[model samples]
Target chain A: MREQGRGDRLTALLRRGPLLAVLVLYTLYTTLPFLWVGAMSLRTTAEISADHYGLPSPAHWGKFRAAWVDSNFAGYFWNSTVVVVSAVAIVTVLGAMAAHALARYRFPGNRLIYFVLFSSIIFPPQIVLLSLFQILVNYDLYNTRTGLVLVYVSLQLPLTVFILEAFFARIPQDLFEAARIDGYTDFQIFLRIVVPVGMPAIVTTVILNFVHLWNEYLFAVVLVSDEDLRTLPVGIQRFMGDYFQDIGMIATGVMIAVIPVIVVYAFFSEKLIQGMTAGAVK
Target chain B: MSAPADAARLPAAAAPRRWWPAARRGERDPGAPSWLTLMAFLAPALLLYAGLTAYPVVRTFADSLYDLENMDAPRFVGLAHFVAIWSDETFLRAIRNTLVWSFVAPFLDVATGLLLALCLYAGVPFARFLRIAWFTPVLLSYVVVSILWLWIYNYDWGALNLALRALGLDGWARAWLGESSTALAALMVTHAWKWAGFNMVVCLAALHALPSEVLEAAELDHCGWAAKLRHIIIPMMRPTLLNLYILAFIGKMKVFDLVWIMTQGGPMWSTETVSTYVYKRAFAWNTFDLGYPSAIAVVWFIIVLAAAAVLHLAFRQREKLEY
Candidate 1:
C-alpha cells in the first residue's frame, strides 16, 4: 500500500508538470516589468546608470518626495481624483436617468436612441478629436479644468448608458406596476427602485469609467496645457519626456502614479475584475 | 456579450416612423414614462452628448472638406485633403501598420488569454495567485508601461539583453524599440501583455460558467484530455472567444496611447498609427489645417467599421449560441 501510494504521487506530480511550467512562465512575463520598475524606482541614479539590473543597497527614498513635491505629482494626482470623481458622479446620475428612459419606455425611436448612444463605443473617437479641439479653443475653454471635466462627462456617457441600459432592460414590469399602484411617481421610482436595484451594474460602470478617465491621455494631452491642469497620466508623460536621462526620477514618478492603483487592485481585485469585464462576460 | 446581441437586433427594429407596436395596440404601459418624465430623464444626457460627441463628429466630416489652417479664413478644397493624405508617406505607413497591429495583437491577446484560462482550469500549483498577478499590468498607464520598457529595452544593460548575453546569445540581442524593424512589433507585445489578462478574466468566467455535467459525461465515457478539449471545451467556448476577438480587434483599431507613448511613431514613422498620425499633423506637426488629418480620420473610421463588420460575419459563420 505504501509503495502504491508513492508511485501514484510521483505520477500525479509529473502530470501537473507541463501545465505548471507554462503557468509560472507567463506569470513572470506579466510581473517582471513591475518588479523591474519597482527596483529601478528605489536605486540611485548613479547605481542605475552604472548597471541596469542592480538591487538598491540603501533604496534611496528621496526620489518619491522629489517627484511628489518638486515634480508636482501631488498636484497632478489631485487633479485626476477630482476629475475622475466628478465625471463618474455625473455618469452615474445621468446614466441612470437616460438608461431608465430608454429601457422602460416603449416609445417610438427608443431603439434608435439606444443604438445612436452606443454606436460611439465601436466608432473611433479620434475622428472627432480635432473638431473638439477647435470647439474648445473657440469657446475660450481651451485650458480650463471645467472644460476637461465636461469633456470627460460626454466622452464617458455613451458606455455608461450602454452598460446601464442592459441592466435596466431586464427590470421586471411587475415592480413598476406595483410602484405605480402605491402612488409612486416615475421620478420617485427611478430614485427609489431603479437606482438601488441596478447598483451592481452602476458600480461596474463606475469602476470602468474611473479606470479609463484616470489613465486617459489623448484628451488630457490635447485639451489642457497648464502644468497645474495636467492629470496624472499627462503629468507622468511630461516628467518622462523632460527627465529622460534621470532614470531614478522616471521610475519613481511611475511608481507614484501606479502605487495607488496597485493598492486598490489588491483590495478590490475580485470586484475590479468582475466590474471591468461586466460588459463582456455578463 | 450583451452588446453584440443588441447590435444584432438593431436592423430588425430600427424603423422610427411606427410607434412601438405595444403602444399602437392601445394597451397602456403603466410602467411607461410620461413625455414630461421621459424628456427630463433623457434630455440632459442627449443634450450633452449632442453638444459634444455628435456635433464634433459632424463638424469633423464637414471640416475634412476645407483647409481649416490656423486663423486664416477657411478654404474649401473639396476632397483635396483626402487626395493628399492618401499620397503622403506617413499616412500610408500608418494605414498599413494600424491594420496589421489591429489584427495581430488582438489575435495574440485572445490566444494568450485562452491558454492561461485553460491552465487555470487544468489546475496549477497556485492558481489564485497567478490569476491576480497576471492582471497587474492592465492597471498601469500606457505611459508607465512604455517608460518601463524603455528601461528594459536599454541597449547596454537592459534585462532582456542581459539575459540573452547570459545565455550566450549576444548576437541576437538588439535595440527593440530604437530600430525600425522591431519598433511596431515591440509595441504590439506590450499591448497584448496588458490586455491578455482582461481576456483571461473574461475567458475564465466563461470557463467556470460552463456546465459540469458535460464534463462528467465525458469522464464517464472515458474521454481523454485532448479529445475532451477538442470536441467539447473549445467548441463550447467559441462564442466567448469570438466575442473577445472582436473586442480586442476594435481596441487595437483605436490604438493610440501605447504607440504614442512607447515610440511616438519614431525611427522614421515605423510605429505610426492613424490616431497618432492625425494628432501630430493636426496639433503638433506645423500643419494646423484640420482638413488633412480629418480626411485621414474619416477614411480610417469607415475602414474600422468595415473591418469590424467583416470580422463579425466571418467569425459568426455557421455559429450557434451555446448558452
Candidate 2:
C-alpha cells in the first residue's frame, strides 16, 4: 500500500516514462516502413508524390494485376517457389543425414567433419562467387533453375546441419539401443526413430531453409542469367529500373514478394526466431 | 559462427575448446555406427559442401596466384595479384570503407538491440506484438528493403524529407543515397534497422535465462535499476553480447546486396565494401579475369579471419558466470 502512495506512484511513473516512450517509438520505427509500403501499394503515384499521406482512400487493385501479369512477377514467383522448395527438400534430407551421422556416431573424423561444416558459416558466400561461376559454367549448369537449386542446397546446408545436429545430439541414446535389439539398420533407425522424433527440429530446419533460400539473391543472380530462370529478387531488381517512377507499382511488387514469407512467419514465428539465433541460444 | 555451450566455458581450460562446435558430452558408446555407415550418412552433405564451399575456398586462394585475366591457360604469377591490389588506390578505399562499416554498423545494431531487449524483458506493453513487428524486417529480402529505402531516400518526395519539412527542419533534407559523405552511414542505418531485431531476440533469450534469484537479491538490497543493469545483468550476459557483436561485425564485413541494390557502390564508390568490389572486379569490370578479384577476396578473407580471432582473443577469459 505504501508503494502505491501518490508520491511513490509519481516517482515510478517518472522512472518508467522515458522507457515506455522509447519503446513505442522504436516499435513505430520498425513497423512504419512496412505500413508505408502497404499504404503506397493501394494509392496512386500522383497521390503519393503529392504528399497526400492519408489512408488508402479508394484503394486500387490494378497495380497488383499489372505486377503479376505484365511485369512477369508471376513467372518470378513460380521460379522462386520451385527453386526454394526443391533446394529445401534436398538440403533437408542431406543435412538430416549428415547431422544424423555426426550426432549418433564416434567415427575417427567425426569432430573434423563437424567443424568443417560449422566453420563455413563464417566464410562469406561472396568469396565463392568467382570459382563457383567458373565451375557452373564449365559443368554447363549455368543459367538453369536446377543449377540454382544445387547452389542453394550447398549454400544452405551448413546452417541446416548446425541446428539439426544440436537437436539430434540430445535425443536419448536408449532409442537407438532399443532399435538395435529389434534388428533395425542404421538407415531404418534414421527413418523410423530419428526422423519421427526429430520432426520439430526438422520442420524448424525446413522453415528456416525455405526462408533463407527463398530470399537468396547473390548466387541466383550469378548462377542464373536467363530472364525466364531469374528468381524473384533478381527479376524484381531488373524490372525495377524500368518502372522507376511507379511507386505504387513498386510497392505492389514488394507486397507480392514478401507476403508469402510473412505468412510463413505468421504461422511459425517462434521457430523462425529460434533458427535465426540458432547458435546464440541454448 | 559457433556459440560454444555455456557449460563448455565453465572450466579453466575453456580457451581453445570454446571455439569448437558445440557437441554432445559422453554420448559415445556401443551405439556408435561403423565407419562405412557413418560415411553413408555423411557423404552426400560432405561432397556437396566440399564442392561448393571447401573447394571454392581453396580454388580462390590458388587462382589468386595466377594470371587468369585473359582466358588463356593459367599463368602462375605468384603473389603479384595480391601485391597489386595492395597498391591499388580504389581497392584500399574499399578496405577502409568495409573496416569502418565493420565497426560502426555492429555497434549501432547491438546497441539498438540491447535497448529493445531490456524494454521487452521489463514487460513493456504489447511485448508480443512489438517483438513480432520488430522482427518482420529481418524476413524481408535485400531487394525489397533496398527498393523501399530507395524510395524513402529519394530527393523530391521521400517520406523522410517530407517529415523533416513538416517539422520545419527544411534545410536538413538531402539525397541520402546520393551523397558521398552520408551514403555509407545512411546504408548502415538500414542495415541496423533490418538486423537489430535479430540481436534483440538473442539478447532477450539471454535475459530470460539469467538467474532470477540474483535479481531478487538485488531488489532486496535496493539496488537501483541502472546500477543493477550495469553491475549485474550486463556482466552476466557478456558472452552473448560479445557473440552478437562479433556476428554483426563479420556480417558488415561481408555485406554486398544492400550496397549493390541501393547505390551500386556509387557516388564515387562511397559505399564500396570488399564484397561489392570483388564482385565488380570479377564480373562487371569486363576484364573477365577473376584472378584480381580472387586476390582481393583472399586478402579480405584473411583480414576477416584475423578480426574474428582478435575479437575472440580480446574477449577471452571472461569468468563463466555461475549465478
Candidate 3:
C-alpha cells in the first residue's frame, strides 16, 4: 500500500507538470511588460538607454510630477475625470429610469424600445463617426467638454440600460405593488425603492462606464482638437508625438494614465469582471 | 386576467354575465402604471439615444448618397461613392486587414483565455494572484497599452531587441513596428495581450458555473482528462465560447485605437483598417470628403451586422448541452 501510494503521487506530479509550466510562462508574458514599463518609469532616460533590463540606480520620482505638470497630463486628467464623471452620472440615472419602465410597466412599445436599445450594441461607432462629427459641429458643441459628455452618455446608454434591465427584472413585482398600495407615486416608488434596491447593478454600471469613457480614444481624438480640451488618451498620444525620443518621460505619462485604472481594478476587479461578462454569459 | 380566472373557478350560478371582453382581459391591468408615466420615464433615454446615436446613423446613410465635401452646396450623387469604392485599392486593403484582424485576434484571445481558464479550473497554486496579474493589462487604456508596447518595441533599447542581442541572436533583432511585414502582426499581438485576460475571466466564470455532477459522472466512467474535456467540458462550454467569439469578433472588426496610436495604419498602410481609413477620409485627409467615409462606414456596419447575424444563426440551431 505504501509503494502504490508513492507511485500515485509521482503520476499526479507528472500530470500537473506541463500545466504548471504553461501557467507560469503565461503569467510572465502577461505581467512582464507592465513591470518593465513601471521599472522604466522610475529610471532616467540615460539609465534606460544604458540598460533596458536594469533596475533604476537612483529612482527619479520627479518624472511623474514632470509628466503631470510639464507635459500637461494634469489638464488631460482633469478633462477625462470631468467628462467621464458627468457622463457616468447621467447614463446611470437615465438608464435606471428607462430600465425600470421597461422591466416593470408593460406598455406600448416596451419590447420595441428594449430591442432597439439592445440591438444598438452591435452597431459600431464608426458607422456614425462622420455624421456625428458633422452634427456636433452644426450644433456648435464641438471641442467642448459638454459635447464630449453628451456623446459618451449617448454611446454608453445602451449597455447601461441593457445591464440594468436584467438587474431590474430580477426585482420582485410584489415589492413595487406593495409600495404602490402604500400611496407611493410611480416616480416616488422608482426613486425610493428601485434606486436603493438596484444599487449593486448601479455601481457595476458606474465602474464599467467610468473605465470605458475614461479610456475612450476615437471620439476624443476626432471631436475635440483643442490642446487644453483633449482627454487623457489623446493627450498622451500628442505628448508622445512631441517627446518621441524621451522614453522615460513617455513611460511616466503612460503610468500616470494607467495607474488610476489599475487602482480601480485592484479594488473592484470582481465587480468589473461581473459587469463586463454579464452580458456575454447571459 | 385574474377576474376571468376567478370567474372560471366559480360555480355556474356565481359565474356572472360577461363583464369585460375576454380577449382584452389581460391586456391592461388597472394596477399597472399609466402610459403617460411610462413615457415620462422612457423619454429621456429615448431622446438622447435617438438624437446622438440613431439619428446620426440615419444621417450617415443620407450623407453617403451626396457629395458633401464642398460644404456650401452639396450635389446629390447617389451611389457614386459606393461605386468608386469598388476600385479603390486603399479601401480594399483596409477591408482585407480588418478581415484578418477579425479572424486572427479573436481566435488568439479566446484560445489563450480558454487555456488559462482551464489551468485555473484545475486548481493551480497561486491561481488567484495569476488571474489578477493577467487581468491587469485589460484595465489599462488602449493608449497606455500602446505606449507600453511601443517602449518594448523601441529600436534602440527596447526589451525585446535587447533580449535578442543578449542571447547573441543579434541578426534576429529588427524594428517590429516600422517594417511593413510585421506591423499588423505586432498590432494584433498587443490586442491579444490586452484582451486575453478579459476573455479568461469570462471563461473562468463560465467554467465555475459548470455543474460538478457532470464531471463526477465522467470520472466515474473512468474518463481520462483529455477525454472528459473533449466529450463533456467542450460541449457544455459551447454557449459561452460562442458568445465570447462573437464579442471578440465584433471588437476586432471595429478596432481603431491601437492601430491609430501605434501605427496610424502605417508602414505603407499595411495595417490600415476600415475604421482608420474612414477616419482618414473624413478628417485626416485634406479634402474632408464626408460622403466617401460615410459610404465606407455604412458598408462596414452592414458587414459587422451580417457577421453577427450569421454567427448567431449558426450557433442558435445547436442543441445546448444541459447538465
Candidate 4:
C-alpha cells in the first residue's frame, strides 16, 4: 500500500507539473506589472531610471502627496466622485423602476420597449458620438458636469436595466401580490418592497457602473475639454502627457486612480464577476 | 353584484376591467399594474433613454446625410461623406487597423482565457488565490492600465527593455509604442492583458456549469486527456465559447481607450481604429465636420450589425448538445 501510494504521488506530480508551471507564469505575468508600479511609485525618478526593476529603497511615500497636490488629482478625484455617485444613484433608481415595470407589468409596447433597450447594448457609443455631441451642445449642456452625468446615466441604463431585470424577475410575485392585497399601490409597493428586495442587484449595478463611469475617458475627453470639468481618467491622461518624464509622479497618480477599484474588487470580487458576466453568460 | 345593470352602466370600462388583471382572466399576464401606473414606472428611464440614447442614434443617421460644420446649418449632401471616406487615406487606414484588431484581439483574449480556465478547472495549487490574482487587471480602469503598461513599455527605464538588457538580449528591446511596426501589436498586448482575465472568469463559470459526470464517463472510457477535451468537454462548451467569441469580437471592434491613451493612432497612423478616427474627425482635428464622422459611425454600425447577424446565424445552425 505504501509503495503504491508513493507511485501515485509521483504520477500526480508529473501530471500537474506543466499545468502548475503555466499557472504560476501567468499569475506572475498578470501581477508583476502591478508590483512594479507600486515599487516605482515609491522611488525617485532618478532611482527608477537607475534600476528600473529594482525595489524602492527607503520608499518615497511623499510622491503620492506630491502627485495629489501638484498634479490636481484631488480636484479630478472630486469630480469623478461627484459624477459617478450622481450617475449611479440615478441609474439605480430609474433602472429599478423600469426593470420592475418590465418584469411585472404586462402593458402595451412592453416587449417592444425591452427589445429596443436590449438591442442598444450592441450599438457602441461611438455610433452616436457626433450626434450626441451636437445634442449636448444644443441643450446648452456641453462641458458641464450635469451633461456628463446625463450621458453617463444614459450610457449605463441598458446594462443596469438588464442586470436588474434578471434579479427583479427572480423576485417572488407573491410578495408584490400580498402587498397589493394590503392596499399598497404599485408605486408604493415598488418603492417599499421592490427596492429592498432588489438591493443586491442594485449594489452590483452600482459597483459595476461606478467602475465604468469613473474610468470613462472617451466621452469625458470629447464632451468636456475644460480643465475644471476633467474627470480622473482624462486628468491622468493629461498629467501623463505633461509629466511623461516623471515616472514616479505618474505611477503615484495611477496608484491613486487604481487603489479604490482594487479595494472594491477585493471586498466584492464575486459580485463584480457575476455582474460583469451576467450579460455574456446568459 | 347585479351584472346586467353594472355592464349597462359602464359599457366603456368593460374592456379595461377585463384586462386590468389580465393573468387571472385566463389570458396573458398583462402584468398586474394598470397602463397609467406602468407608464409612470417607465417614464424616468424612458425619458432618459429616448432623449439621450435613442434620439442621438437616429440623429446620427440623419446627420450622416448632411454637410455640417461648427455652428453651421446642415446642408443635405446625400452619401457624399460616405463616398469620400472610401478614398480618404487616413480613414481607410483606420478601417484596416480596426479590422485587424477586431480579428486578432478577440482570438487572443478568448484563447488565453480558455487556457487559463482549463488550468484552473484541472485544479492547480492555490487555485483560489491564483484566480483572484489573474482577475486583478479586470478591476483596473483602462487609464490606470495604460499608465502601468506605459512604464513597462517605456524605451528607457521601462521594465520590459530593462529586463531584456539585463538578460543580455538588448537587441530585442526597442521603443515598443513609438515604432509603427510594433505599435498596434503592443497596444493589443495591453488589451489582451486587461480583458483575458474577464474572459477567463466567464469561461470558468461556464465550465463549472458543465456536468462532471460526463467528464468522468469519458475518463472511464480510457480516453486520454486530449481526446476527452476534444470529444467531450469542447463540444459541451460550444455555446459558451461562441458567446465569449462574439462578446470579445464586438468589444474589440469598439475598443477605444487603450489605443487612445497608449498610442493615439500614432507613428504614422499605424494603430488608427474606427472609434479613434471617428473621435479625431469629429473633435480632435480642426476640421469640425460632424457629417463625415457621422458617416463613419453609420458605416461602422452597419458592419457591426451585419457581422453580429452572420455570427448569430452561423452559431445557431449548429445543434446544441444537451447534457
* Alpha carbon deviation, residue B38, candidate 4 (Å): 1.4
Candidate 3: tens digits of C-alpha lDDT, residues B1-323: 24223323322111111111112222222466777898899999999999999999999999899989786677899899999999999999999999998977888999889988999999988988898888877777899888888877878877788889999999988899999999899899989999998889878977898899999999999999889889988888877787788889888988999998899999899999999999988898887679888998999899998988887776666644343
Q: What are the runs in model 4 whose C-alpha is more than 4 Å off?
A: A1-8, B1-32, B165-168, B320-323
The predicted structure with the larger DockQ, 2 or 4, is: 2
In model 1, the Cα lDDT at residue B105 comes to 81
Ranking by TM-score: 1, 2, 3, 4
TM-score of chain A of 3: 0.95
Candidate 3's TM-score on the B chain: 0.87
DockQ of 2: 0.49
- Reference-based lDDT, each prediction: 0.82, 0.83, 0.83, 0.82
| Candidate number 4, chain A TM-score | 0.95
TM-scores of all predicted structures: 0.93, 0.93, 0.92, 0.92
Error of 1 at B269 (Å): 2.2
User: Which stretches in model 1 have alpha-carbon errors above 4 Å?
Assistant: B1-31, B320-323
Q: Which tens-of-lDDT digit does each residue in B226-322 have in candidate 1?
A: 9998999889888788888888889889888888888889889999999899999888888777888888889988999898778877765647443
List where candidate 3 sits over 4 angstroms from the true fold: A1-11, B1-30, B165-171, B320-323
Residue pairs with backbone overlap in model 3: none
lDDT of 1 by residue, A209-254 (tens): 8988888999999999999999999999998789778888888988
Q: Taking the tens digit of each residue's C-alpha lDDT, what string does model 4 give over B171-246?
A: 9999999999999999999999999988898788778988989988887899998898788878888877877888
